[model samples]
Target: MTTENVDTLEFNPISAASRNGGYVALGTLGGKCVVLSNLSKNVVKLSPSDMKEMDLKTVCGADWCDDNYTYFHPKQEVMVFDLRRLATDIIRECQVKGVYVESYERKSGVWLMPDGGLAVNSRKLWRPDGTVLEHGIHAERIYSASGDIGFDLDTPAANDDEVQCVLNAFGGINWRNNLGAEMLLGWFGVAIASVAMRRRPHMLLTGAAGVGKSTALEMMKWLSGKLAYASTGPQTMAAFYQALAGTSRAVILDEFEADPSRRHSRDTLEIARMSYSLQEGDEGIVRGTPGGTARSYTFYSPFLAACINPAKFEPADVTRWVVLEAISRKPDAVALKEAEARVIGPRLARRFINRWANFQKNEAIVRKHIIDAGGDGRMADTVGVLLASYWTFVSALPATDSEAAKLVELLDIQDRIALHAITDEQRCLEAMMSKVLPFKFMDGIALVTRNLSIAEAIQRICDDPTGNLEITMRLAQLGMRVGCVQGTWRMFVANSPEHQELRKVFGGTKWASGGWSTVLRRLPGGTEGTQRIGAGFGAAKVTIFNMPADLLPANDGSALLAA
Candidate 1:
């Protein structure tokens, strides 16, 4: 064709062409014919026929010949020539920078390569329009075909070695703030993990001040390589989502405080929830964007653990967490000193890695067991894949049934705490009540008298309680009517004739305040000066009345029952 005519020809290129339908034209350039293809509205020149002929000889490569063509040049690049021009142009151009072209055949769409001759036996090429031309048995194809042919190859063999490795890496023991108690309580965590794998499992750990929750989390970090710690509250859900999308493992959230000053916005939480279920590239702006953005964001690594102090959060936050109540007993000085002196962190990490490797070897069995225990079956594979690297740490440690039991217990406690924090007002009230009355009295009250529900009572206590008297008033409003009778304010059953029964159960006279004083009176030498009073005394004599029997149990049976 003449140059003017060639220039006049439209180069409107479709995204891709099919092998059976698309066309490419060759025009004379100098004395040689130059291959060209339409790219949307523009025409781009390809290699000259003479150059293609010369390069075909020197460019040693492997070519796969089938319905579709794939060419791989040794020490060069790879290219796929499909019958469809759209697919051919896009795939070729996109991968061209990374591959070297060698010999190609136009008619058969065959390519020759230096690496593996006739590699096309199991390859597939896709056109720009998303049509696939199967050349060889692809991994996905094999999986599909096997199912179609009733091969029944879906059963996964257990990797006992891998499971053992992971168990070892974790030191067979899972540590937490309340090591003894949490060991018994951590089963809820297992359940949660199982659930998360199926749906989206996210956990938040919170506990009282001075608890070693942070320390425990740090230990987990050493075990799980896919952990990331967050130190501040300004981090947006979007940022965290993006971070998680890149990793295939779990994340470790550390020092997360539910401080009102640092609380995440509602939008942030929504995004976070969305992120848990979103795969990479499946995430996009569902709203807010003008035309809506299609995000192909990558998947974030799952969070392995999260740790926070209970004091840092409000009661409203309990629902979102699996709390591990820290041990009230302070760590012994000698234990603290030893921990401080030794470089246990790195050792722990190494142990975890070794255990993970062992676990990976037995993954199938372990996963099956986990699934049987209510874990997500789909994530059975991931459990092994993700934990395989940290198994050594657990294997060498002293792991016992007791420890496992303890872990399950702790997990249960956390679940309870989370549920109470989220939905149950009585639990919140119990927590608040503990601060005012003895912890033992948390569930002792027959009725709570307060203007508001348990939630309101707790909130009021948290917000403004001038003194014990105000607390008494708030409690009275709920139901456990506390009033000044005989000049002493005391809790009493509202309009109940079972005053004697209440006294016997709670250990105090009808008018006496049944609390610390009554408890103290039962102690040795505590009730020496205490005086007993007859029933029906007015509010005046109630203060002087001391009925230790009201506080004392009738027998060990009653005490045990009360306990």
Candidate 2:
């Protein structure tokens, strides 16, 4: 290399500090002499061959002196041997400090470039006062394989209406309602904030075959710009995890399904489950490596999935997803252009880079708005980030009254969905109530009725003793009993072979192992302690769940109840 070229290479201050302190004799990584280069604007590792090929004196830059040439470079191979020996001796004891990163990263609210510049966005270098830096200092040193990689900003320069243009184009999709479009916008905001936010929500687009789900996903990919990894159907769990392993970039998948019956589907769902919360310390999903050790991965990436049939997840997993349904396109509806998104995306990214601090400040206001409107804490985490981020961008501009009102409508719609969501326990109870518990009566003749719940059958037997004689006798044979406990009705379900069918109703529930009492106690007016109640079935003191006398109205015990 030429002297002029070598003059531009930046000396490593961290290595100098470490050498002076004697923490490490040489700040070498992977058997190479590592230094910061201002020309490349990256931490460059140079091997002995590389040093030998370059103009040694010039490449040494400010670190060079006459003594350094006599002791270290008199014989090039000897210096290599010496460095290799030193590496062997102190490698385990010393904590080497240097910029070993190979990709773009965000640290402490500042974006770090591979070229050693501090960027405000993918395109512009950062300045403290919200202006672009022309020739900023190449001084920030970050050590991470955790990539928040950036791409070239190919959009037009920021204009006054950039954010509005992005939103208006998004609203052009064939979404079922205004709420769906608004929520999609909110999710886009969440994706923009993925690197910094702790609790990120996922998005799912659903509709019939021709509803433009793929088009919507394509728009998101452009808007995500450099921060998104797009995948199609038939994805493997390993590939999916590898794509998101160390990055916080959003994953946008079209025709994605997570059916548990398939091994890969289950694995994909499991990765999604693990990505939801940022747990304490290094808690994460562990996979065994070929080296016989384990690598723990915690992904903070948000996922956007598009599918025709919705994937069924356990209730907890369901809460993590924000599903947007598409509608049949009107004949004149303008199709979303991937080309337009490519430009608008970078523009939105620039806006996010500038407004991130303000977005953090508005979080409290957004959270209160959601909770006060009857949304729960989960909704606060899942929906609040979306609303806050979108609000931050719009409020930065001169927002119209209609823009502000639409936000309120979004919250109102989310609140209603949250309030009406059925709990897992409620689903199990509903299934149980619809079940017909058969028994033999009248000298081995089987008795069955589709017009009553287990509770109502007992209620009928208690209310009309003589008329329900056959029913009462049949229930006694099955060891089922019912009676009033402190003025509230309770049913004692005996642990008998005849009652085994009831346990199937609790499948995929917290009470799946037949531990129905634990979950049933969480129901309204239900008690943790089982009641010992006598019944028309013969006064047997069996332990069972307590239910309010009128908790479940009579139902034809045929099919499972709708949630």
Candidate 3:
């Protein structure tokens, strides 16, 4: 606070015209109230306290500044020695500010300090008191007890009725289908994610159409303000990057378009990958004229996606989300969750956000314990974050409440279940079985049969599924090679003998697009570098395309040869 006022401080100009083009106020750097300026563009490294200093003069020194604060002139009009001090000062300042961090990527936004306190919003980014920069643009922000949001959300004062509403919403969510604890933890993560800038778990609430899946998401949106976009979210890669360039808020996808067998496009999958990359670096994109470059800053934030079926996303991408299920949803009562959201929601959110580091640390402990106790590696990261959020909520609960212990017990059970789910290969097996080998009893073993070609398989699936037929076909083809294959691969795309035998079925231009022998080449005998397509071919050539067949279940979820 030892800043000089503009009216009191005098600036001696070389002449009248150079009175003051402008003066930048520089503050304490490396714990000293010293100032340095040289057109350094790393503005995010500036601290919030430093950003408020008023007009200070910059002395361009060719050699060095005297201890007596004397300004010297250069012999020639060239870049000054002052450049070295400016660079050095910036490096020192960044070290003190933790900006050169390896663990935390951004120099701004919400940061969790090691002491378990939160450095939030402008405190982390060096913005003005009441503004937020999102998507490479600054936007007005209004903060409540719930912390910072991009827009205004009217939440009433904490009241008994609202508290009861929170408890009721917590109690009434259908947890019968083994989803009670995970759902509650997801709610806490959304609340905490409001002030968390790191890569956190995405929440995917799944249930039937009439269920209250969206109700919980709506409540989080109300808490999130303009920061939360409540549509199906960006389906294309460009749109997604545009919608979330610099936002650190909750982006909720209320009714995502999901297809279980669908594989994400390369660019689309990049979005999912970047969503949880949790590293420090720029995801570069070359834009502007040929000679110009602008940094399109990318970041990972919390996202919530809801739909009827949640099994569509690939195994890798699915691990990024904490899935919650609502079996019995009353559409009429959704507004009640919204109303209650306005009351105790912000208070509860503030509780976890203020101590985000504690929750994060606790999450690590829970994750290790779960994995050691035999949790799924796929579910390891997801369960850890969810359990940490749940424990944070429990700690925030009033000790006087009689039901607190019960809630704690339920949370413990939920934690155990999530951990145990990794070992429950039977469920993954059953779900996988439902796909390739639908539920059918044969003798005492379960198996599936088919003789469809690549075109026929694509037709059966794509004839009604959402995404473009071309992309769907392409993904299915990729899956046929990778998902269906076991061990190493050796087969080339297609061969002369295979095409000659399958000429009648895949002869014409329609089925002979990019990969005509996909079905015939992917059969069990595919990896031997050569495959026979049809039953006959005039002793040398045939007229049938690749054929699908019945199979036995291999323990690893791949199809086994039963021929």
Candidate 2 worst ten-residue window by lDDT: 1-10
**Error of model 3, residue 430, in angstroms:** 14
lDDT, candidate 1, 1-563, per-residue tens: 11112222233222232332221332332223222222121122343342342232122111212222344545567554433432334334323223211111111111112221211111233222224443221221110110011001121222445333323322322334333322211221222122123233344555555555555555444433222333434456667555543333344656555455554533344443443455323433432334342323333233433434333323333322234444443433112122321233323322222233243343444444444445444333333222222222234433344433343343333433333433222332233233333211122344433344333333333323222344444344322332223432222322222344323333332222334333333332322221222233323211112212333223524333322
Tens-digit lDDT track of model 3 for 186-290? 455543453353445666677777667766666667655545556653365656667765555456666564553443333444554565644334543424434
Clashes of each: 135, 1, 6
Deviation of model 3 at 60, angstroms: 15
lDDT of each: 0.32, 0.55, 0.42
Q: What lDDT, from 0 to 1, does candidate 3 have?
A: 0.42
Between prediction 1 and prediction 2, which has the larger lDDT? 2
Residue 321 displacement (Å), model 1: 3.0
TM-scores vs. true structure, each candidate:
0.34, 0.71, 0.50
Which 10-residue window in model 1 sums to the lowest lDDT? 142-151
- Rank by lDDT, highest first: 2, 3, 1
**Model 2: per-residue lDDT, tens digit, 106-199?**
3222343454233543344444244554321244333221223343333333455866666665666667554666567667767765655667
Worst 10-residue stretch by lDDT in candidate 3? Answer: 135-144
